[model samples]
Target: MSKLAVQLYTVREEAGKDFIGTLEKIAALGYEGVEFAGFFDIPANVLKNQLDRLGLTPVGSHTSIEQLVDHLDEVITYNKTIGNSNIVCPWSEVKDEESLELLVAQLKKVVQRLQDEDMILLYHNHDHEFKKIGENYLLDLLFEKCEGLYAEVDTYWVHHAGVDVIEYLMKYKDRVKLIHLKDGIGNELKAIGEGTAPVKQVMELMQKWPIEWVIVENDEPSPTGLKDIERSMICIKNQF
Candidate 1:
């Protein structure tokens, strides 16, 4: 079964102010794991100790493509020390076929390198990725070209792009390791189970997939970050 996690990007502001304290709050709110957006420059070992104390699993970290390609060794060492094995490239802009090809080439190398270190690379998407280049969507093309590149599907964006979320996810079922169980109407973000995204249906479908984590995220938290995720967690707990 997939475990419950929250993307730290949802709580980026609070984390910026008090990283460890923010983690404590997340744990208190009943999140079993965390997907980190940044480390606030904390030492790896130190972060590991805090996570251990809080009983939180380091599900994954969103590392940039540039960091993965140029500073992979350091990125790998840091995450490994904190007991994380998934490194996600959260966002990338590919303006045309040429740029897409370049991204594919760079990511292929990053995938192999991560595999060498017993880690995996996953691509996170936004609505732009659903745009078609020729006959195929950019996202499909990227996955097709970059062998061993896994997916971290964000449900809201898939819906926002005017695609059938279930149909789209089924296409990459084998490669999807993480699900960003988000909710929103158009561009305005909402707490999970409180928006137009197919949250319930997706949660049902998730049980059948070999997904590792179901991470909750609200790109623009309403009111405050902690309160937004607290409501999200309540919905998640009710479902599970």
Candidate 2:
């Protein structure tokens, strides 16, 4: 079965105020793992020790393309120290064919480098990725051009793009390793089950796929970040 994790970007404010404390609360809320957005300047060893004590796995990290290109050694060392092997490129601008080709070249190199270190590079999607360039969706061309690049499909964005989320997932089934299980209505984000992004259906498919993690994310958390995720966890637990 796929494990549960939360993208820390959902609770960026809380994490900014108290990084370790926020992680402790996430652990208490029954999330098995965490996908980090930023380290908040915390030392990797100290962060690892806390994660170990809290019994939370380092699911992945959303790293910037610049860091991966210029300071990959530092990125690797820090993530390795924290026991994380999956490095995700959270977003990239692919406005046109020119930009698409540029990103593909950059990611190809990054992917190979990560492979050499036994780490995986995943690209997280947003609505823009669904925009078409002639016959193919930008996302399709991206994956096709950049061999060995894995996917971290964001369900909400797929829905926002007016694409059938399930169909999109099926299209990239072989390359999808992580899922950003999100929900929203139009442009507004919501806690998992509180919006219409086929949360239950995605959960149903979880058993059939070799997904590493189903990561919950709320780009704009309402009420409070903790409360939002707590409610999401309740809904997820009920599904099981």
Candidate 3:
């Protein structure tokens, strides 16, 4: 019952060139939805029309906190048009413990404004979130403070930080409504379900967390990216 999607950021090179055609190919590859990054200068309505034409749903998107800070109205306006209700803050420039504390406070404001507009704000974690932000880990602190905040848990990062995906999911399942289904490469980056995420276990836990969508992504990829992704999707589907 865990249907799949792809984060367009995983194949951003293809999207930068053929936007709509790339979406067509994604659909052909059996992805039911996508997590967006940008419109590539295509008007919001045009982008929405093409996605509708292809029956693709926007499960989430990687948006900047600064933009959410400066242009929240624009952010909510476009997402609503695209049939998406989730906005993800992908990364921040903050470094070190002190900076992380400040970042959390800054992002809480962004989360609050986003919620005021009736949109869910998600924090997309990197390996750094494992470092402490306050009394708890940065991930825990952000989730605790940003009342409306949620997570787009990236399985690989959980493992990268030496945390168990199942344990983390169990601990914060309520805060996680979506997930980035990216797999690891032992010590490298590869396609989803291809590396070291305990992917099978992660899939099994879905019944409890009840994710809306699992988005396949790879920060960097092996040369056989498409083939690997295809295989990963097959692995996910057969988990039932």
lDDT tens digits, residues 1-240, model 2?
799999999999999999999999999999999999999999999999999999999999999989988999999999999999999999998878999999999999999999998999999999998889998999999999999999999988998999998888998899998999998888889998888888788888897888879999999999888889999999888865
Clashes within 3 Å, all models in order: 0, 0, 0
Q: Which scores higher on lDDT, 2 or 3? A: 2
The order by descending TM-score is: 2, 1, 3
Predicted structure 1: lDDT: 0.93
**TM-score for all predictions?**
0.97, 0.98, 0.92
Q: What's the true lDDT of residue 232 in model 1?
A: 93
Clashes of 1: 0
lDDT of each: 0.93, 0.93, 0.79
Q: What is the lDDT of residue 34 in candidate 1?
A: 98
Weakest ten-residue segment in model 3 by summed lDDT: 221-230
Error of 2 at 100 (Å): 0.4
